[model samples]
Target: MALRHECIQRASTIGSNLKDGGPRRRWAAMLVLTSALAAPGLAFAQDDGALDIVVTAQKRSERLQEVPIAITALSADALDNAGATNFSGVVNMTPTLNSVPYVTNSDTLVLTMRGQGEADADKITKDGSVGIYVDGFHRSRAQGALFDLADVERVEVLRGPQGTLYGRNTTGGAVNIISKKPSGELGGKAQLTYGNRDYVRLLTSLDLPAWNNLSAKFSFLYSEKDGYVKNIGPSNDYGELGNLAGRVALRWDAGTGFVADYQFDKGRTRSTPPYYVNPSLVGVVPGYSDDPYQTYRPVDLPVSKTDYDNHGLTLSWDASDLVTLKSLTGYRELKAHSFTDLTVALGLPTFPYNIDQERRLKNREFTQEFQLVGHSGDGRLEYTIGLFYLDERGSNALFQNLTLPFGMGTVVTDRRVRATSESKAAFAQLTWTPPVLDDRLELTFGGRYTDDKKTAARSIVVNGFAVETDIRNRQTFNRFNPAFTANMKWTQDLTTYAKFSTGYRAGGSSEGGGDFTLTYGPEKITSYEVGLKSQWLDSHLLFNLAAYHNKIKGLQIDIPVDAFDPSIVDTQNIGSGTIQGLEVELIARPARDVSLTASYALVDTKVDTLLVPVGSAFDPAVNPGSPFAVGQNIADRFVIPFASRNTLTLSGDATFLRVGDNSFSAHADFRYQSGFYGAAGAGPAVPGREFYHAPSRETVNGRITWARALEGGSEMRVSLWGQNIFDTRNKQFIIAQGDTINGFVSQAAPYSEPATYGVELGFKF
Candidate 1:
C-alpha cells in the first residue's frame, strides 16, 4: 500500500512539472523518467523465476542468468504480444539497434547495432556490422534477415564482441534465432488480422506426432496490405507482400540422441515508390501533401515486384554426455525487377522516362560445427571447444532505359556483378568455478582463429559498348580473439562482472569499376565492459546496467564515382574510429497484475583518421586541359550514419484476470532517436552523392488484448494495435540531385508510416 501511494505521488509530481515547463522539455523529462522507472518491471516479467531462459551464446545450452554475457532474450509469447512480425519490428523495441528499409524499395532491409553499421545497402560487397543467425546457421547477407517469423522459440541478442565464440562476422555482435522444434503432441493454432489499407494476415501452426521418436510441425503465414501511395498507371497502389513457409523435424533417442530439421520460406512483394515530398512545395503546389497526409503524381511509375525464397536444414547429434556435433546448410535466391521514374520533365515539352531495372541475388552456404564440452578437475572446470566452416556466393544486376528526342528511340544500359566468399574458423573456451570462496567467483577465457577468401566480377554495357572486368582477390586473415571475465556474487541477490574482449570483421572487395584496389583490410575492435545484474525486492524487481568502450581500427568506407564525368570522382579506405556507450535495462513487477519495462542507450562514435585518393594534376581529355585536377579527400570525419546517439524506450503492461474465465491486457510503448547524417559527401557535386542528413523523430505504439478461455481447453483472443500513433512525419531518405539546370533536384521522399490500427483474432487449442 505504501509503494502504491508513493507511485501515485510521483505521478502527481510529474504532472505538476509538466504544467510548469515547456512542452518539449516536459516531454523529454517524462520520457527519461518513465523509461527509468519501467525497466525493472519489464525485466522481471520476462525473466521471472517461473521459467529459465536458455541460450546458446557459447554453443552450449545454459541459463541466461548464468551465461556471464550481456544479452537480452525474448520468448515467442513476448514477441507475439509485442507484435514483432518482422526484423524491423524486433529492432524497434530493442535498444542500440536500428533498421532502415529502402524508401523506394521495401525489399531492402538494413540493420545497424552498437554504432557500427553499413552506410550503403546498394553496394554488393559491404556487409553489416552485426551478423544474424537462425537455428545455428549463419545468414551472411541482409536479405535473409528481413524474413518473417513463423514459429520462433526464442531470440538472443548478444552485445559487444562475440568473436571468440561466433567468429569472423562478430565484430559488433550477433543475433541468434532459435526456431520451434517438433512437438510430441498433436495441437494447432491459427490467427487472423484485419486493418486499414485493406490489410489482411493469416497465420497457422500444426504439430503432429507422426511416429514414435519422430514428430513434425508445420507453420505458415500470409499477409497483404494495399500501398499508401496511389499508382495512376494501373490503379494498383503497390505495397503488398505474401509468404508461405513449412518446417519438419525428426528426433530419435538411439542412445546417441540425434535431431534433424528442415525449413523453407518463399515471399514476394510489390511496393510503392518512396513518396518523396518536396517540403518546399508542400502547401504551395496544388494537392501537395506531407507526412500523415499524402499526395501523388499523375504519371508516377509504380514499383515493380520482388520475390525471395530460402531453404535451410540443421542436423545435430548429442554423441555422448560430454560432446555435441551440429551442421547447418542453407540456400537462398532473390529476384527484383522494378521501374523507377527519374524525372517528371514537368513544365517541359517532354514526358518522363523509366529506369527499368532488375536484380538477382543468390547465396549457397554450408556450415559444420563440432563442440566438446565436459567437466574436469573434480567438476571445478567446464570447457567448450568448437570448429566452424562456411562458404557463400552472391550476384546482382541492374538495367536502365532512356528516352531521346528526334525519334532516337530508346537506349538501354546494363550493369552486372558477382561475388564468392569462403571462411573457416576454430574456437575454444574454458570456465572455472573456484573451489574456494564458496564458489562465488567464476572465470571464463576463450579465443578464435579465422581465414577468409573472396572473388568479384563486374560488366557494364552502355550505347552498345561492352566493358568487362574480373578481379581475383585472396586474403588470409588470422585472428586470436581472446576474452577474460570474472563474475562475483556479492550478496544473495546481486551479481557483478567485468570483461575484456576482442571483435573482428573480415575484409571484402567492391563491385563498381575503379583502377585502384577496391578491397579494404579487416576492422578490429577491443572492448572493455563492466556490468551488474541485480534482483531485489524478493525477485520482483530486476536491474541491469553496462558501460563499454570500443576502439576500432581499419574502418572501410565507400567513395562514389561520377559516371557522367569519369575524371570527377571515386571512393577509398578511410581511417579509424571509436565508440563509447552506456546501456541500462530494468524490469519490475511491483504489483501482481502490473508490469513495466524500460531501456536507455547513449552512444558517441567518432572517426580518428582519413584516407584521400591521390590523382594526377590534370587529365586534358576529361578535365578540359585544366592545370589543377580535382581529387577526393575525407573531410567530414567522425560522422556515423544510421545511428542515433541517444535513444530511450519505455513500455508498460497491465493485466487483469477476472471471473468468467476472461482476461484483459493493455500495453503502451514509446521510442525516440536523435538526428544523424546519412551519406558521405564533401561538396555534393560528386556522382553517387556522398552525404545526406536525417532529422530527429519520435513514435509511439500501443495495443490492447482481451482473451477468454473456453471450457474444452480452447481459448479465443482479440486485440487492437496501433503504430505511429502520433502520425509523426519523418524522412527515411533524401536524394539531392536535380535533372534540370535549375537547382531543383528531386528529393526521394520516404515518409514514415501513418497511424495504423488493426484488429487481430487468435484461437488456440
Candidate 2:
C-alpha cells in the first residue's frame, strides 16, 4: 500500500466522517483497519510454551494476552538480544512511540505517543504529555528520561490515557521501567565492547548470596567514544559520548510476611552537541563538503553535560491471604547544562547572526505512593486503591550573546526562571468476573481525583539593564478522571475489549518577561479505544490490534515570535482537536529456533478549532507575519505538527546452528517513518517564511552472536553489531535556507549514530 497517500486521505477525511457518522462510523473504520492488517500470511498467535510474557501493566501480575489494555512489554533478555543500548533504540522497534530530542540538548527527550504529545522537550516549565515512571515513581522532567538502562528487568509501554492508575501528565500514555531486584543467589556477569571511532564500553554486575533473609545486588557501567563527525575548529568532534553510572539495591525480608527494598542510582554524562552543517558552504571549511554529517566551525567546541542521582525505598506487607499493602517513596535530583552554536557557518567578524548561547537547568523532586491490593475469597473480585503525592522545584537559566566585531556594540540577553509544583491524587480501581458466561466476561471501573498547584517567577535582563525582575504568580487546578473497560472472550484463545478513559495536564505560567497574566489553562483528553488480542495455531502465532479516537480540549501550544530568539516565544491555550490511530503487533515462531515480530501504526491528527486572543502574537492584526489572523477562523489551516502519520517495524531472530556446547544466532530489525512537519505547529509555508519539514526515512540494524559454555558453569559470548547499516542520511531537524535571511539551520540526530560496526564480549556465571 502507498502509505503516503493513505496518510493524506485518512487525515483529510477524518473530521467530516467523524462528525457525520459519529460512533458507528468510528467502529466501522476500526473493523476495516483490522481486516486490512490481518491479510493472508498474518495469522493471530498467543502464549505458547516459549513465548509466555508476563506483565504488571494493571498493577498486578498477569499474562500479556489477558490484559485488556494496549501495552507492549519487552524483557531485559530481548533488549540484550536486539543490541538496544538506550530508549531511542527501543523506540524504533515499538509502534506509536516517537522520541525527538530538543534542539538545545541531546540529553532531553520529547516523547510522543499515538500522535499526542509536546515538541519543546527542553523547557523546564512545560510538562511532557507522556508520563514516565521508574519502579512505580514518576519522573516529572524529560531532562532525565534518557539516562542509562542498566540493571533493568523489563519495560512496559501502555498506550492511550493512563488516567486512573498513573494520573500525572499521562494524556498520551505512560512508560513504566522495572529495575532488576535483588536475588538471593551468588552470580556475576561482565561485558566488554569495542567499536569504530574509538568506542569502548564496560558493564559489570554482581549478586551477593542471601544471608539473614537479606539479599543485595550491584551494577556498574562505563562507556566512552569519539565523535562520528569531524570538526574544522578548535572544539572536539561532534556526537561524542562519555557516560558513567552505577546502581546498588538491597532487599530485606522481615518476619510476618513483610519485605522492604532500597535502591540508589547515580549517573553522569559529558559530551559535545550535535554538529550543524550548511550544504551551501560546500568548500568553505577544511575537509568540509555537501554531506550533512560534516561540519565547519571556527570557534572552540561547545560542551553538554548531565548529572543525576536517584534513591527509592519500597515496603510491602502481606496483610492477609487475600490482601497486600505496598508503599513507594523516592527522591531524585538532576543538573544539566548545554551549549550550542546557532551560527552554522564560521562566524566571520562581519556577520551579524553570530549567536552563541548556553542554557542550564537544575531540578529536585520527591514522590510518595501507597497502594492496597485485595481480592475476594472466590477470586471473582479484585481491587486496588492508591494515593500519590509529588513535590518538585526547578530553575532554568539562559544566556545568549551576539559576538560581533570588536568595535560593534555587543547585544546580550540573560534570563532566569524558577518553578515549583506540588501534586496530590487518590485513585481506585475494581475488576469483577461475574459467574455468568463461564467466567469469560470481565468489567473494570476506576476513577482518580488530582489536585495540582504551581508557582513561578521570572527575571529577564538585556545588555547591562534589567528589563524585568521578580515577577511571581501562582495557579491551581483540580480534575477528576474516570476509566471503564469491558472484555469478552469469544473463544479460548481470543479476547476483545472496549475501553474509555480521560486524562489531563496541569495549567502553567509563562517563563518570559515579568507578566503575571501570561498563563495557560490545562489541557484535557477523552479517549475511546477498542482492541483484540488473540493466539492461534497452538499458540505458535500471536496478533494484537488496537484502535483509538481521542477528543482534546484546550490544547496548549508554544508559538515562536522570532525564529532566532528563544525568549520571545508565547504559550497559549488553543481550541480543540481529534487524534485517531490504529496499531497492530504480531509475533510468530514458525519454527522451533526462529522468531519474528512486526508492528505498524497509522496515526491521523486534525485541528478542529483554533481560538486565540484578538491581539495575541498569533493574531494577524498584531503580527502580520504570523500564520493566524485576528478574525478569520484558522482551524482548517492548522495541522498538528511533529507527528508522523505512518510507522512500521519488523524484526526477526534465528538460531540456525548448534555445535556441541556452542550455538550461533542472528538478528535484524528495520523501521520506516513517513514525513512529518518539523516545526512545533503549523507555520507559514510561504517562500520567504522559515518552515521545517522532516523527510521520510528508513533504518536497519543487525547483529550476530555466538555463545559457548565455559569451564565453570558459566557461558562466554561474542557478538558483532551494526546500526544504520546503510548510512542513510536521514535528517531529524532542519531549518530551510538558514544562511539566507529567513532561513533555517539543522542537525542530524546525535543518537542516530550513522553506519557503525562494533564487537562485544560477555561472560556469565
Candidate 3:
C-alpha cells in the first residue's frame, strides 16, 4: 500500500521536475519548433548554431514559436535519431500523446492527444477524436495508422482543438505527417537494418532531376521480425510482424502562376497478435519460465492482415498578389482482417474451435478541399477561407464463439455493421495586427460551419437469437464552432497568448435495437488555454509552456448488454466531465558539440455528473441486487481509461569527436509515464468489473552513429541502437474477472515488449 501511494505521489507532481526559468525550455520548443518551421516556413535564424523552424499550424507559414497554438514539431533527422519508424515510436518523447496499441490487435494503432482520444471499446461505427493527416489528407479511421512512415520530411503535433479551420472536426487535436517532395535533384539513398529476433528492414528512395518541367520521386521499404513470445506448438510465436510499403510522387511547375503535385502510395502488413496471459497460469507454458512473453500458442492461429492504398493531388494557382487559390483531392481505401485466440492463453485447451473469433474492417474515404489564402494589401491583415467535403463508407464484421468453464454454457456471436458519412464544411480565419505597440499585439478570429449526414445498418445474432437483423437508421447534425485568440509580443524573444475554442465529436444512431430508432447526441467540448513561447540566450534555447481546461458535455460512454460479453453493447451520452492539463517543453545547446531537450505533462480528469435515470441498467433501482453494485454512485468513482497522470522525457546528444570528413555521435533518451487505468469497459463500479490500473514504468533508449564521406559525393554511415535497455516488463493492459459462473470471449491481458537492439547500414548520394 505504501509503494502504491508513493507511485501516485511521484506521478502527481507535475511542477517539481521543472526548474524555474531554466534555459533548457527553448531547446525542445526549438527542437520541435525550428525543424517544423525551417523545413516549410520563413523564420529568422539569428545564430548559425541555433535552429530555425517554420510551420503551417495556423494555415500560414511562420515561426513555430510565434504561432498561437501549442505545437511539437520535429524533422526527419530527429525521428531517425530516435529510431522512430512509426508514430508510436515517438510517444515516449511527446508528453501529450497517449496511445493504446493492443486495442484489438496491432493493426489498430489508436492515438489520442490530451487524455481524450480513440477508446479501446469504441464502436466500430464511431470516428476517432484525434485527427491524423498525411500531407493534409485526413485519415478518418485508426485501422491503418501504424503503417511505416517511409520517406517523411517533418511531423507536427498540434496540442489544442483546431476544428475551426481544419477540414475534419476532431475534438482532441491533430497530427500532420508531411513527406518530402520531389527535390528536382538526382539523388537517392539505400539502407538496411538488422536486429535480434531475426529483425530485418530494407529501405530505398530515388529522386530524379526535373525534365520538361516535371520532377519525380520513388521510395519503398520492407520490414519483418519474428515474435518474442514462445509458442507451445508448430504455429508461429505471437507478436511477429512483416510489412511492405511503397510510394511514388510527381511535381510539375508550368513556369506560369500554377503548380501541381501528385502522389500515390500503398502498404500491406501481416502480424500476429500480442501474446496475452492469464496471471494465474503464467508458469504453465512449455519451454519458458513465468513471463509475459511466454504463452501456450493455439494451433493454426492465422496471422492478421491489413492493406491500404492512397492517392492525392494538389493544385495551386496564384490568382493575384492578395490571393492564392488551391485545391486538394484525395482518395483512400483500406481492408483489414484479424484473428485472435483467447482460450489458448487461459489454459482452456479442451475448448474447441481456437476461439474462431475474427474481425474484418473495410473502409473507403474521399476528400476534396478548396482554399483561398492571402494577405491584405496593407500587409497588416491575413485570412484563409476553405471549403471541405468528405465521404466515408465503412463495414465492420465480427465472428466468434466462446466456451466457458463451470458449465457457463457456450456463447456465440456473428455481427456486421455498416456506416456511411458525408460531411461538408466552410471555414474562415482572419488575423489582424493593429497599429498599436509596434504591431506586436494581434487578434485572431476563426469559425467553421459544418453539416454531417450519417447512416448505419447493423445485423446482430447472439447465441442464434437474432437480436437485430438488417436494422438501419440515419441522422443529420449541424454545428457552427468558433475560436478567438489574443497574442501580445512582450519582446522579440517572447510571446504570450490566450485562446478559447470549441469542438465536438459527431453522434449517430447505433443502428441497433432491432426495430427501435436508438440514438445519442454528439459529444461536445469547450476549451480555454494560455501559454507563452520564448527564445533566449542568443536563440540557442527555446521554451514553451501551456495550460488548458476543458468542459465536456454529452460525453460518449459505453456498456455491454450482458456483463460477460462486449461484442454486443450500447453507447450512451450519460457522463460529463472536465479534463485539464499543463505541458512544458524545452531545448538547449549547452556546448558546441552537445544538445539536450526535455518535455513533461500533467493531466487531471474529474467526473462531475452522470445521469442514471430510473430505467437505465446502471441504476440500483433498476436491478436492486445484481452485479451492478447496488446504491453505487458511479460518477463519484468513474475514471478515464489509459489517461496517464504524469509523463516526462529527457533526451541528449553529443558529437564529442569529429575529425576532418569523419565524425562520431551518440544519442540517448529517458522516458517515464505514471500508471494509468486500462480497461475495455466503464460500468457501474461492480465487483470484478471495476477499472484496472497499471503500474507506472520507465525506460531508457540509446543510439550511437559513425559517419564518413565516401570517395564520390556519397556518404556511408553505421548506427547501433537499443530500446528498453533494462527490459522493464510492466503490465500496461489488464481486464480481470473472478467468476462465479459466466466468462467472456477474451479473458487474457497483454504486457509490454521486451528489450530490443538493432544495427543499421546506410549509403546516401
Each model's total of backbone clashes: 20, 10, 16
Tally clashing residue pairs in candidate 3: 16
Q: Name the runs in model 2 displaced over 4 angstroms.
A: 1-50, 279-291, 345-352, 403-409, 512-516, 620-631, 683-690, 735-751
RMSD of 1: 5.1
Please give the RMSD to the true structure for each candidate, in Å: 5.1, 6.9, 6.1
Clashes of 2: 10
Q: List model 1 lDDT by residue over 1-765, tens digit each.
A: 554345434533533432123455346445434432332112232434332346777777776556678887776776777777777667767778877766436656667778877655555555667888877667666643456777788778888877667634576778888887777678778999898987787888888865866677777777777766555455445344444445554544443477766776666655544545444444444454443243355545555566666677667777666556666566656666555443221111232232333445555555666556665636678787777777777776766566554566776667677777777888888888888789889899888887777676767777788855443555566667888999887776688899999888777666553543446668788999999888767766566788898988777655434312111123344566788898877665676666656677778877665544343212234334333224433333325556677776666666755667899887666667766555444223333333245676677777789999987788999999987776766767554432211122334446666677899999987
Q: Which parts of model 3 are misplaced by more than 4 Å?
A: 1-47, 121-123, 281-290, 344-356, 406-409, 463-465, 509-517, 613-616, 619-633, 680-691, 711-713, 738-747
How well does model 2 score by local distance difference test?
0.74
The stretch of ten residues in a row with the least summed lDDT in candidate 3 is: 33-42
- Residue range with the least summed lDDT across 10 consecutive positions in model 2: 34-43
lDDT of 3: 0.73
- Provide TM-scores for the models: 0.86, 0.89, 0.89
Query: lDDT by residue for model 3 over 484-581, one digit each (tens)?
Result: 99999999999999999999888865532223256667888899999999987777667788999999888776544444443434566667888999
Q: What C-alpha lDDT values do all the predictions have?
A: 0.63, 0.74, 0.73
Q: Per-residue error at 139 for model 3, in Å?
A: 0.5
Error of 2 at 665 (Å): 0.3
- How accurate locally is residue 130 in candidate 2, as Cα lDDT from 0 to 100? 86
